[model samples]
Target: MFELLGIPPQVLFGQLLLGLINGAFYATLSLGLALIFGLLNIINFTHGAQYMMGAFVAYLLLNLLGIGYWPSLFLAPILVGLVGIVLEKTMLSRLYKLDHLYGLLLTFGLALLIEGAFRQMYGVSGLPYPIPDVLKGGQNLGFMFLPNYRAWVVVASLLICFATWFLIERTKLGSYLRAATENPALVQAFGINVPRMITLTYGFGVALAGFAGVLAAPIYSVNPLMGSNLIVVVFAVVVIGGMGSILGAILTGFGLGLVEGLTKVFYPEASNTVIFIIMAIVLVLKPAGLFGRAR
Candidate 1:
């Protein structure tokens, strides 16, 4: 097999696969974050906790109620999304008129409360989420073995990302959403229910996180701390990709994941900080991010 820069093709491809998988999660989570930020102007720090909640919800459904993976995949996001709606109605809505920092502080507090509660109840250990039987095996791709579940994750995430982008960018509903985001008063004057839109947008963003959680559950241990760690890297990803662009977030996420994966194969030590380093470079070179527009 051919080698590049002292790395074999197999190893490179394997890391690339891993990177793509990570990028899927990054893309999904960041897109959710970007949507919330773009529309609500709120930095949702609790996004990771909501993702953790999605995994826990799936676990609960399976272990407690005997629900299978397929059902939980759909149900988990809906449940978590409803919770988001409730939070927006009860707590988040109050801060809409306040300084943006208040929104951040409130969400940060919510994240801590959530993570702390789950840790107290479940401890730090992770629980296993079995992959569906149909996706149990791998395919030999000449130089490497590709797990069915991982492949599914990449494909499914891409589909969802593009679908979301289309809905927000191309559709009439998306036009209303953009209009509301830009001028809620004027949109309301035009007969749109701005508050309902905000609530649903938050719910939808939370749902995206839930979807990611279900996908991640089979790959990583379903732990309370899972979202906490992943959120930081995702934040870096959002920063690098730019907050204003949905497609940018999607592209940056997958591209960074590939870069990170290759780094792991060639220099494992740098893999951890590679994202932050990239964020820093992007900041120095383009303060608004690779695809972000200046505010």
Candidate 2:
């Protein structure tokens, strides 16, 4: 077999594919964070917990209700999103005029509370979610084998990310949303319900997180702390991408995921820390991030 960098092509390509898969999840989750922070100005520490909730909800639907994965993908996000809307109306909205730290602290507390509640019930053991029957196989691309479900994840995540970007950047409704974010008072003066728009935007962002959770369920073990494990890395991706920059978040998430994957192949020990190291470098050189604009 031909080799690159003295590594087998299979190993090299396999790791690259694995990197892309991880990138899909990172992109999806970070995109949600960017949306919430950019439009709502909320740090949203509870996002990880919301992600955990999506997986749990899907698990419950499948085992308890026999709903299966296909339906759970859509249903889980909607259900979790409704909960997010309630959180915005009942609690998050009040902090809009306050310091960003306040929103961060509140969401952080909520994350702990939610995680604690799930851990109490589910314990720390992870649960398996079987891949759907239709997506159970793999394809050999000569150099590497690609699992069907993993391919689906990459395609689905990229499509959703693009759709979200287009919605926010190239549509009429998106213009309204951007307008409200920039100057809510003026938007409201023109007869738009700014508060409601903000609430829905938050819900949509939470839904994106929930959607990512469903995609992750079959790939990773489902557990209360599942989100806890990945959220930090995702936050790093958001920071490196420039928080609140949609395009930046999408591109950066995938880019870092590939970087992490390759690091694992070349230097196993550094793979875990590579993303953070890049983050630190980005911070020192450009505090605003690679894609973020300084205010």
Each candidate: RMSD: 0.8, 1.0
- What candidate 2 gets wrong by more than 4 Å, as runs, is none
Compute the lDDT of residue 256 as modeled in candidate 2: 93
Candidate 1 lDDT, 156-236, residue by residue in tens: 999999999999999999999988878899999999899999999999999999999998999999999999999999999
Q: After the best TM-score superposition of candidate 1, give how far the Cα of residue 251 lies from its true spot, in angstroms.
A: 0.4
Judged by lDDT, which candidate is best? 1
Give the clash total for candidate 1: 0
* TM-score for each of the candidates: 0.98, 0.98
Error of 1 at 284 (Å): 0.9
